[model samples]
Target chain A: MNVIEARHLWKEYGDNVVLENVSLAVKAGEFITVVGTSGCGKTTFLKLLLGVETATRGDLLLDGKPLPDEPNADRGIVFQRYSVFPHLNVLENVMLGAELAASPFWGRTFGKRRRAIREQAVAMLESVGLGTALLKYPSELSGGMQQRLALAQALIKKPRILLLDEPFGALDPGIRADMHQLILSIWRQTGLTIFMITHDLKEGFYLGTRLWVFDKRRHDPQAPNRFGATITYDIPLGHTDRTTLHTIQQSLGANHD
Target chain B: MKRLINQRPSRAAQVLLGILPFALLLLAYLWASELRLAANPNDKLLPAFSSIGEAIWSMAFEADKRSGNYLLWVDTLASLQRLGLGVLLSALMGLVIGVANGAVPLFRAGLSPLVMALSLIPPMAILPVLFIVFGLGEVSKVALITIGIAPFLIRDMQQRVLELPEEQLIKAQTLGASSWQLILRVILPQVLPRLLDAVRLSLGSAWLFLIAAEAIAATEGLGYRIFLVRRYLSMDVILPYVLWITLLAFLTDYLLRVLTRRSFPWYYNGGKP
Candidate 1:
């Protein structure tokens, strides 16, 4: 069964439309990445999925239930700009989710609950290669490390699903590639489902099992007709092997047809 | 980053720096005894640094024959009582009002302008009005300090709390942190350092106001002592008292800086943004 399913999802901003008639589904533990140009409403889609924003119309389902209106520990999010709390040390940032997430037994308890969860945070940080840097502040670290911390913050809670909004889009090419690989490794180890949004097709091809493309029709008649904002294609997990990669590369060289 | 340029020198260096100016003054005062002997070195008028120290050692510290140790003790107790009451009342009232105004949009819009105006008007300017309402009693001085300082603390608390990042708030709420939990764990921790600074700032300002406060219609206070000496044209007493006040202010500011550093180390060391 699909872990996440959306039917005729519509997101509108005043008069302009961001995403319309966007429907998609993902199997459990699938690594899906949504790719599009700058204004493609990809970020909006991720926000909607993470419950940071609401859909204008249509139904959003999470494991067959109605989408929650706000964020939940069941789904963790990482943003392009690192969301690592600048005031909290790495360990605290990671454990904060669990402490505040309200486990049945941990409720009505404070410091005692955190002590146990802190060990979990350290192990998770160790998994992310941040064992030595767990006490360091985000400002003291480099950008790539901060992203790693953000990833660690999201992962430590052991959320069943993770949502990333261009987590590597802001990094340099080398770091971005490293982050992509690290994310893949973590997903494999933790078996957490991921849905990432990015504009880089190469990244989408490399890391994503499933991919969606957003396009917007231009207002200028003189220019090629394309979406100013809309999703154009949604491709499957096995859709991108060597030949499909070549096809996307060739298609890029040929120009928008 | 690039070596912080010793913004705060070591404690020894600070002590050395503080004493150096006095040393120079002492040398000058002693040198004047040779050829430039200012006619009368103990001229109750100019009370040199050494004389002021001697005078302070005589008056503020000396036994009060009339009030029996009672004069000094009573002044100290009275000042402490007024200060403690005013600060406590202001902190409690300030945090509540500040949090309310900061958190609520309508209240912030409607009342912030008034708070801003209150903060701008000098408390000394209206000292006479306060005296008229509360009279020259302990109530007048404490009330004056409370109203005079609470707005700034309230505004500081309000702005700092309000400025807490929306992303963190949303993150906490998503984690199921109730409103009270959010304030205790998230908002208060973030706002506290700034709140402490505001309190200290208001306290120092109130200390200055205290002297002006006690200068009128009262029998005893640090300020009253200073005012009484001024009436007698006794620079010996006035000079020493002024030095005491200066030293007190310096020590208080230093203590506050150290306390803040110790309490809110998170503030000094960068943490989760």
Candidate 2:
């Protein structure tokens, strides 16, 4: 079944149409990475999927139903920055989703239940290689560690779909590669649907089972925003290996630049 | 990251750097007092340090014959009570009004402009109005301080709440946080440090209002004593009271800074809100 389906989605802010006629049917457990030029509405598409913003027109469905009007547990997202709660430590950050889901209004659950949640959070942190830093604040973590915390914070909620908007865009190349591997492994283990947007052509090709390119095919100088970006290219990477796709796309993307 | 170039001063130098100006000012005052005393056997304007010390000792230790209370301690307690009550009330009101103004458009539309106008009105200008409404008692004084400071605090808190990154709020909602849950767990914790910082910033104005109200009308308070001594040209008492107020304000600010650093280390260290 398609976990997320967008049919002729349209988003506009005032006169600026961001995404127009964008359509997709994303299956469960698929790693879909999107690459686009800056201001090509890639992030806007993610926001639509995350339901932070409603579409100006068209329909987006999650599980073949209308997309949620606002953000909900069905979808989780990690931004490039400020994703984790800085007030909470590593463990508390991961545990917040459960706590909010359970005893959201007041004091946290006590006794065995609280301990059980803590253990679960610790295990989640351990899986993200952040078990040792459970007591540390987000500020104390390095750039890489903080992003890992962001991942753990999102993953702990067990959302059906995870949306990432350039989660590792700020990291160095080495750390970004490591995060790429970590995310791929998590996707494999959990069989979770993943949608990510990146400016790096190579990273996009290396990770996703399918690739989407968003761009405006026609631009009018008199009315530059007359056409919004759409999924101009949707390529399935089932047979192409990462290296081969990267090499070919590197040249193609270089030209598209 | 670029290496931090400047080296910290040695411990001894740091201490000396802090004390040198204060020591110089004290020496200057002592020298001026000596010249005055030589010119006149008893000059009330700049009484000898010993005379100020003696006045403090008497007021602090000796019971007043009329009131049967140690005037200095009584004044300190009264002043502290008024200041504490006013500030506490302002903080609570600010949190509520500010959060509402920030999080709810209806609340913001109804209250924000009015708050801005109230903040612009000089707090001292409303002293008579407060006195007329609440009468010449502790209520009037506390009300004066609260009204004088609360508006500013509210605006500070409102701006802080509004400035919170949009991503954090969205992320919380996605985690299945209800609107109230998002506020209590996410917004409140982040805005708390900013609240304390605002209180620290507003302390000066709070003290200003407290003293203005007390000086105008009060039976016993630090400001009352200072103003009362002015009639008899008792600089000895007045100087000591002024120093005491400064010391109290400094200590409060220092304590708040330490508390913010200790309890919300991420706030200062991360520089995020």
Best by TM-score: 2
Q: iRMSD per model?
A: 3.6, 1.7
Q: Which stretches of candidate 1 lie over 4 Å from their true place?
A: A101-115, A133-142, A169-175, A220-228, A237-257, B1-44, B70-77, B94-96, B99-114, B117-122, B125-129, B132-135, B271-273
Worst 10 residues of 1 chain B by lDDT: B33-42
lDDT of 1 by residue, B1-273 (tens): 457884777899999999999999878755654333377644566655566677656565777777656454467667767877888788887787887787667888998999999989888888888999988898888887887889889888898877776766666655556666666566766676777688878877778777778887578877888888787788767766676667766776688889888877667765344
| TM-score per model (chain B) | 0.81, 0.94
lDDT of 2 by residue, A1-257 (tens): 88899888999999999999888899999999998888889988998888878999999999999988899989988999989888888999998999887796763577888888899999999999998999998888888999999899999999999999999999999999899889989998999999999988778876889988888877777887888998877888767666766555654465346
lDDT of 2 at B125: 83
Worst 10 residues of 1 chain A by lDDT: A219-228
What tens-digit string does per-residue lDDT give for candidate 1 at A130-196? Answer: 8998887677777788788888877766676788878887788888878888998998888888988
